[model samples]
Target chain A: MGPDETAGHYLVANVPRARRGQTVAEVLSQLIAHAHDCMDVVCVLDDDERLVGVLTLAALFALERDRRLGDAVQPGFPKVHATTDQERVASLALHHAISAIPVVDAKGKLLGVVPSAALMHILRREHVEDLHRFAGIARETTLAREAIEAPPLRRLRHRLPWLLLGLAGSMLATLIMSRFEGALAIDPAIAFFVPGLVYLADAIGTQTEAVAVRGLSLSHARMRTIIGGEARTGVLIGLVMGGLTFPAVWLVFGSVHLAVAVAVALVVAGGIATTVGLVLPWLLGRFGSDPAYGSGPMSTIIQDLLTLLTYFVVVSLIVG
Target chain B: MGPDETAGHYLVANVPRARRGQTVAEVLSQLIAHAHDCMDVVCVLDDDERLVGVLTLAALFALERDRRLGDAVQPGFPKVHATTDQERVASLALHHAISAIPVVDAKGKLLGVVPSAALMHILRREHVEDLHRFAGIARETTLAREAIEAPPLRRLRHRLPWLLLGLAGSMLATLIMSRFEGALAIDPAIAFFVPGLVYLADAIGTQTEAVAVRGLSLSHARMRTIIGGEARTGVLIGLVMGGLTFPAVWLVFGSVHLAVAVAVALVVAGGIATTVGLVLPWLLGRFGSDPAYGSGPMSTIIQDLLTLLTYFVVVSLIVG
Candidate 1:
């Protein structure tokens, strides 16, 4: 490694070691030694070598000059898990205003300490990667590799069941359209808003998914609490948005019937989308599945079909 | 508060503290003097009673053993900022793998120490919360009022523009459908596949979005390496599913024209959805938006419009 790289890596490696074997006297000695070395923080580890806690230099200098080292080691400190997803860890730390995180295994054995700097670096790194994934580029297909992973065959398997359900739902949508065939034939304007209504419902679901995912980062509260809050937010968003946009539909299309259909669909979809968005994660988690996977396309597909059905059914009931 | 509530609240506030204006030797003396107290970390603060940095018990123990009091008291260590977001601070500490982090005020004065325990506690809490959010609920609605801030209406503005776009796009979809007037009149069966095709696209997008968002929690290098890998996985999934469903579609639909159309649309939608799912986040992020909203309803709406337009145009040219 070059001089900067070597120096940087050394800084990364040593700072953690300086924090090991924590006790007031030992902590002071390492801080004093590293003060000259210019290290900011040291890692605290549990017996299993997992990160259990952190100790900083400023905290070490607080006791009286005459205070003994043994008197500084206080009991009853909270602990952290080492195997956590680092971004969630970082966000959680922010929520509580903490500086360092303890790294512990599933069984609560401390392995090593993951501090603020490391977590930040990891979060930024992951955020960038997420951006790439969202762009549909193969994440691993580096500029070095330039080879895109062709769409997987198995991906279709995961997608088809939902699509088929949507197919059935679309039949119903068609039924609704037929009910409007007379109006559609007369003005053809009412048809213009169907995609918008579907899209609004789906979007509400999407937003709900994002918020639900964000809420999942909570540790202090139950899942119900988080999901309920998100659902309420979705409904509120839907209500306000639904109220604002359906009129725009009437103005744009000059069809009061279309406007009513769009309004009802958007309003109801907001609540349903939010509810599904929140529900998918919980259901996934309960089944030992990754909650992250629940918020994406599956919810959108299901919500799309449902929203279509709802819009059509409501319109059919009103205009038929 | 009831006993349980009090206990719970106390649990949150149990972060250990270190006194102000003490020397390393003095802190070490008390710690060494009180080894039975289990003082694991210490906080170093300034004369204004603000936090600057942290001192670990381990560092103190090491320092006291070596009698490096003078060296440990230097003003060189990086001061922890009190007003800093906990997420940033936690992440930074993790990157460095430190056990303790110091808090400081705006004037660069010391505040307190955040030990590793608090971080671990928050991670577990968040993991559970994520579980529920994925299921689609509000987290704070059920939690104590103090745990959550009021859901702001400001975020609604971010959502409204997208809905408006969806409205316009949906109208376009309708216009596209209207253009297909003759095709639908010939055989309504083509409409059967519209929802299915759109659903297929939506599902693939979901899988892609989940993978991308989850990647946000991983390391940058890992995320980058995995992006293409994940997309490839999605592609493979698409192919397998496409192969499985194509023959079934051909056998049932019977018309060479419709079958070919179905197969092509499936394959194309699969790829398009996957790629769009991947690409949208990068685009959104480029403009400084949250890529987590990749599975937004607007995407589905727009894709549906595209799907409808593509299908109608393709069918018209081939079978018109």
Candidate 2:
């Protein structure tokens, strides 16, 4: 482990603890006197100051006063090395349905507990951060209130970097569209569906990015399962949307080829959009940057280029 | 005053309450003997069961053994009616940076305390729900794990409704393009920037929607202040993007008029996108729906049609 990996920094060192021989009443009195504001569970320590077991205060409160504190100890509570990350801590708490997570040292000695309040704060902050990053805002402040109230200059500074990348992507999109100039020359109606096709594909991808950004981090589901599920859903959304649009376009434009080209493009674009959305985030997460960093503006531009390519190719294939 | 407005539904009614004159030691023992899982704050009640004051277990623990329980009570803690929404309760907990919030009856009698665990759960649930709604997923399950693992069919059902709306919008987009058949006939180069323009506009509007959806709900900042700030930011983004795109487009397409048309359209589209993004969510929230509902797929289609209108209007005026 690196020097920066210590979990001691995030641990609340003021947790309540008791020796094994203490009576329930005695332990309760001592715990109440020594514990911090978030003292939900009491840790049991041995003579060597090593953590042995733990129990919730609620369970202790329900016990008979004369009972030994050791008798009330709940076995098999999970403890983490002091070097564990806050995400791990929060996940553990959620998994165990426990309010507090115990932090320990190399000797199995109790360091402290990461309190419920801190866990809750970590979860909420991460939630807000993910949302902000997905929106392509660099986030001038951690608090949503502050982010919302930031001056226009600060807001621009925070938001411009992504849109700048978007600017570069938009230029690429222009180049790609120009490459399809022959198709436009062949059938001008081909150019009509460009914005709509790209918009729908971008929208579909954004939804997938939204799901994958948080879903990748928090869900225990296999990546294959998620990708497969989203891809199929994407295909389904495409079929219904395309199936309806096929007749509508034919009726409106009186061109069966144009209609067929659009329906085929929608189906192809939908599948690609979902795959790109899910993959970009998963890849970012694997590389240790936030998964959300790869979503929203980033994925939109990528999906737009792909959707355009798909539309132009299908139009050439069918309309020619 | 309705009979159904009982605070019991949201209340953790198992909280320990104390009378005024008990010693710190006596109260600690009594509280432990009587309290439930969420016993962080001990409520103090008067003779008629009216809420008087509150103190955390930590505060009580630090009090001298001989001190009276009344002396340990923290004054001016916020209380809410039982019928309050969970969002309000969660917000209150976050605002105060406290783990638990007390609930009271119409007559100011103590009902129960909302614990830190419950607060954490509420915030997490709302966070997940907001993300799911933003993605246009109906969310068959509240759990991220469940949502990720849901059958493709169920996922399709949840996601297709929004895409259906998007389909209708696309047809509208197609019709809008058909209206501009003469413009395409004039110079096919005008059609080259359509996908790029719509994508960038949608991206800009999405960022605004992301900010407004959460910002409006959490920030106590005035709505006009937020709107004004966002509008300025939008115009600035437009000017920068438009300024850069003008020279690039003119260089690439060798058509000064087409480049000028695209640049003007970008600036106009940027401002309109931000205004619509901010206003749509605000309006939806005002009508008592989740503000997030106004974002994602619904707003993407709206932004697309608007961008198409702005682009065509500028192109026709410039190239005619």
Candidate 3:
């Protein structure tokens, strides 16, 4: 994890702590004598100051005054290393149904706990960051308020890089369209479906991206299983949409050949789009970048390029 | 709020409640005698069973044994009505830097407090829902895991409604393109810019939608101010992108008229896209639907229709 994005940065060292040998009353007195930033969980340490167990305040409260902390503490509790990513920390807290997560070192020595407030803040920040990245914003603006309220020029700076990259991609798209110039001149109606085909492919791809961005990180399913399911789902969606469009196009344009081309292209583009959407994020995650970065303009352009090629290929075969 | 989405649905009523006359020692004894689901804060009530104040457990623990609850309680603590939206409830907790939020009825009688666990879960769930809605998913699947793991046919069912809507929109795009057949026949090169222009416009509009989705709900600024800033930002983004495209199109196509038409169309499309992106979500929010529903396929299709019209208009005027 980056230095700023680690559990160490979020952990508070001044949380309630106690030795396992201490009695419940003794630990309570010690807690009363000191001011701590987080009191949700008390860390129990051994003679080497290594964490052995954790005791929730409620659990501690329920214990008899004479009960030893060692007997009351719950061993095998969930904890994290200081180098753990902040998102993992928040996830652990959520999974364990605890508000605070304890951070330890390699030797199991107690460091501090990431407080409830910081956990909530981390979750909120990550949510905003993911949204911005999915929309192709350049940097993490940290807050939705700042993202919207920033001066126009500042907003422009954050938004322009992706659009410029998209412009370059658009040039490639133009090159692709130019290759089909022969086909377009043969039948002017061919150009009519370009925007619609590209838009539908992009729309279908985005749904896969929305599911994969966070899902890949959290899901335990193997890549093969997930990819297979997505590919089938994509084809099924394409079939339904294509089936609906075939009659409409044939009736409107009075051409069975053109309708068949468009419908076939839609099915192939759908399969390609869903595959790309799932694979790109999985690849990014493998490469240690954010999976969310795999969506937005980059993947949309890729899907567009493929869809354009698919439509022209299908058109060449069927409309000929 | 809907019945399932209200604060009352998530609140825990069996929590530690104290009368104003109880001393710190008495409250502590009472707490020990009973088990409460949420112990983060103690609610202090009045004679009419109306909530008057709240005291955090840390503060309660810090106080003298003889201190009365009335003297220690903090009035005007942040809270929510039982009918408050769950999103609003979570936002209130984040705003107040509190782990739990008290819920009350119209008479100010305590309903319960939404605990920290519920708050975290709600935030995570809302994040997934917004992502899905922004991608035009038909229904809220609640979990990203569920979204990806559902059976192919089931997944198609969840994802098809919007794609079908997009298909209808695509027909409109085709009709618009058919009208421009005269322009396309005049110069085959005109069709090359369709995909690129439609793409750049969609990319720019998505940025605004990303900013506006959560920003509209959280922002304190008036609609007029937000809209004005977004308009300038949109046009500014357009000018930069259009300026870069002008020379490239001119040099590549060797038609200054075509380049100028494309660039001018780009600028106009940019302005329209940003305005539509921001305004659509604002309108949706005003109409009480999720602001995120204004994005994805719905807004993209709208932006595409306008861009297609803009490009054709500019071509008919300049490239004529």
Using Cα atoms, each model's DockQ against the true complex is 0.13, 0.65, 0.72
Question: In terms of TM-score, which candidate is strongest?
Answer: 3
In model 3, pairs of residues that clash are none
Off by over 4 Å in 2: A1-9, A32-37, B1-10
Which window of 10 residues has the lowest lDDT sum in candidate 3 chain A?
A31-40
**RMSD per model, one decimal:** 10.9, 2.8, 1.9
Q: DockQ of candidate 3?
A: 0.72
Report the Cα lDDT for candidate 3.
0.85
Question: Which candidate comes out best when scored by DockQ?
Answer: 3
Q: Write down the TM-score of every candidate.
A: 0.59, 0.94, 0.96
Q: Which TM-score value belongs to model 1? A: 0.59
lDDT of 3 by residue, B75-107 (tens): 668888878989998888888778788888899
Task: Give per-residue lDDT, candidate 3, residue A123.
Answer: 81
Going through the candidates in order, state the TM-score of chain A alone for each one: 0.64, 0.90, 0.96
By lDDT, the best candidate is: 3
Assess the local accuracy of residue A241 in candidate 2 as a C-alpha lDDT between 0 and 100: 82
Error of 3 at A208 (Å): 0.7
Candidate 1 chain B, poorest ten consecutive residues by summed lDDT: B4-13
Model 2 docking tier (incorrect/acceptable/medium/high):
medium
